[model samples]
Target: MELEFAQQFVRPILDKISSTPSSSELIIQDFAVIMIVASIMALISYKLKQPMIMAFIIAGMIIGPNTPPFSLITHVEILHVFAEIGIILLLFVIGMEFPIEKLKNVGKKATFIAVAEASGTFMAGFAVTQAMGFTFFDSLFVSLAISVTSTVIIMKVLEELGMIKDEATYLIVGIAVIEDIIIISLLAVLQSVASTGDLTINEVGMSIILVIAFIVGVIVLGSKIVPRCVDLVGKTNHSELLIIAVLGVAFGLSFIAFKLDISVATGAFFAGVLVAESKMRIATKIIATPIRDMFGALFFISVGALMDIKQLPLFIIPAVILIIVSFSAKFITVWAASRAQRLGKTTSLKTGIGLSSSGGELALVAAKGGADVGATSSFVLPMVGAMTIISTFISPYLIKYGWKLASRLESKGTGSSDTK
Candidate 1:
């Protein structure tokens, strides 16, 4: 009897020990490490007068799997999930600030500029990649990936430079909004082409139609319904409830967009627009800002983590070429388009510089799509990732100096006119 009791007790103890979950512990440890590294890098970036996003990315690189000595994150997948949430929240806050009425003001000009820049960049990227001996699909994917500028990077740079209130800022943001819509539609078409090796006219038409319907339905119906719902929640006078309700709407729309094969970022943005229509807009923004900042940092960090530094050297030359081609194409296109719209030389120049930096979340999406369908070369994703990191790193500097250049040009033009 004594021996039986001892065996039973020991068996129970072993079962308990084996059943203890370690994944959760690892996840917690990863988050702690990410925050510590990110904080240190952010402080360093601030001291160097660089964008905090750049610092976060650098921190991610240091602790990421690419850096063997400091690869502290054991659960990269979980970090990606947090990064995605960061994107949704970042776009959501932006949407709240830019409402339907504001969009209407810049709609036509923004659309024209966005289309021109996207087309020009696509052509330039395609030609360059093809000349470098990339396969047809690889060239196509790279071209498409480089065409769209990073909205997140642009917004963050503008905010950091205290240029958020500039007249050119409005136009720049409007163009970004239009580009988001265009890129989402193009991404769908590209995916279809990749999977089937061909794209049908019907597929193209249907994709466009779905995009239009989603935008219209959300704006028209959401404006009417969402505001009232928020108002009802606001009447409750519970700040927590108000925040919860708004977040629910944001996540709900994002989920719906996912189901409809649309980008979740788009849905999150529209959710913000709808919320902006409510009386509680200010309160909603105040509550959402912290959430956005936290997740936004994670998003950029994840971008850096995705970089395989070992593979970068192999693709460095082509990546550099791509960056030059895409940046030059975007700058020229946006500048010419802005001038054509009579936005003034200073505004035009600033707009051009602001939009010059390429590669972003959508570029990554395009790269991943290519990889998933096995239609792109092995170099495609890594090359795009490299471009993203480099472009993002330089975007803040471009904005800061670009403003000075615009001012100088304006002064010179004024002097010439006065002399005349």
Candidate 2:
């Protein structure tokens, strides 16, 4: 009945739109409506004790093409491209926000910790996928998808809570960088195999080497070249010109990576990191901030829009089990890593919690990549969405507990000294 009705009703409208070239203006109209709604919802959400990002997502879900009442949004090819632009800008800002000196100070220990925690988690997740009868490629995507955490959401939550400059924040930031590097590297390999088809699993090593080489190339060239370009553009004293330059570097590099089967976010991130050490980076980030916020909100909305709600409940049991397993897995590993690095017990615990909560971007990347490779079904989406929801709710409490533990430990140490 649904199929017959869809063919008669929905299919005709879709066919009419496709057959009509003059419907181009309708695309712009749809974009405007979604953006306006997203902005208002974000602002209202702030007044309600929630982050603006959450509101943007909920707004998207409500007005999405799948919904009934708000039939405003249309699924368009242009929206997808714009959404891609949003993600690139978002990642570029993430790179700009990274402190190079802090990373250097944390050094090898943080590197080891990030690698160990991520690797162990991935292995565990991969094992689960295999036992559930998944193929090698599917297991690979599932492992990578489930294991990596969202750095953006966690850091934002920490900052909103005034925990940004604390010990826990430091550990979380450092570990997230580690995880991002690992997951991105793996993605580069996955993309190469998927695109080439005949590339086979054995060629994974070469692809990884190429990815590493590209990263090193970005570091060497981006630092020297990107900042100078920004500086030159700034001297023109034209704000539009400056915006154009930043967007050029971000999008140009992203396009280059896309042509090579590399992810746009990966390219944008490196583009950010390369210029991180530059003096003009602050100015660049300031100019790019509004642009990032505007389009980045769209990216999140696209995520919510893409969610397959019908399968959500079916994926619930597996999602719960995976979230529990993955969260537990990362918690101990990161907690231990932070402690070994002398972040202390409380900070370590909070850092672990911060790293565990993820949503939106990285999971979407993994699931998209999985489906692209024919490694998984649409089920990955619901599983990821559910995990994201649970983590979002749980992280703050874990952070609160971590702070309490730190205080109690500090008090005990002080009392012992007094007794002495």
What tens-digit string does per-residue lDDT give for candidate 2 at 1-420? Answer: 999999999999999778754566778778888888887887888787665556866676666665555456665455566668787898888777764565567667678778878887888888887887767777777778777787766776667677788766776677778777788778777777766665655677667777788877877777778877778777887878877887788888788777777777778887777556666777788889998988887776776666666567677777777777788788778877766666655556566767766554676666666655565666675466556666655665665565556556657773121221
* Candidate 1 lDDT, 1-420, residue by residue in tens: 987987889878888678865998889989999999999999998898766766877787888887776678899988778876886797788789777887777678899999999988988998998899999889988998998888777788778778798888888888987786677556655655566665578776766677678888999999999999999999999999999999999999988977776667668888999999999999999988998899888877886787777887789999989999998999999988877776676777788998998877677666755765688977787688778778877776887788777777678785121221
Quote the positional error of residue 236 for candidate 2 in Å: 2.1
Top candidate (TM-score) = 2
Native-to-model Cα distance after best TM-score fit, residue 295 in candidate 1, in Å: 1.7
Native-to-model Cα distance after best TM-score fit, residue 268 in candidate 2, in Å: 0.8
Return the TM-score for each candidate structure.
Answer: 0.83, 0.84
Question: Which structure among the candidates has the greatest lDDT?
Answer: 1
The global C-alpha lDDT for each of the candidates, from Candidate 1 onward, is 0.81, 0.72
**Model 2: lDDT of residue 378:** 62
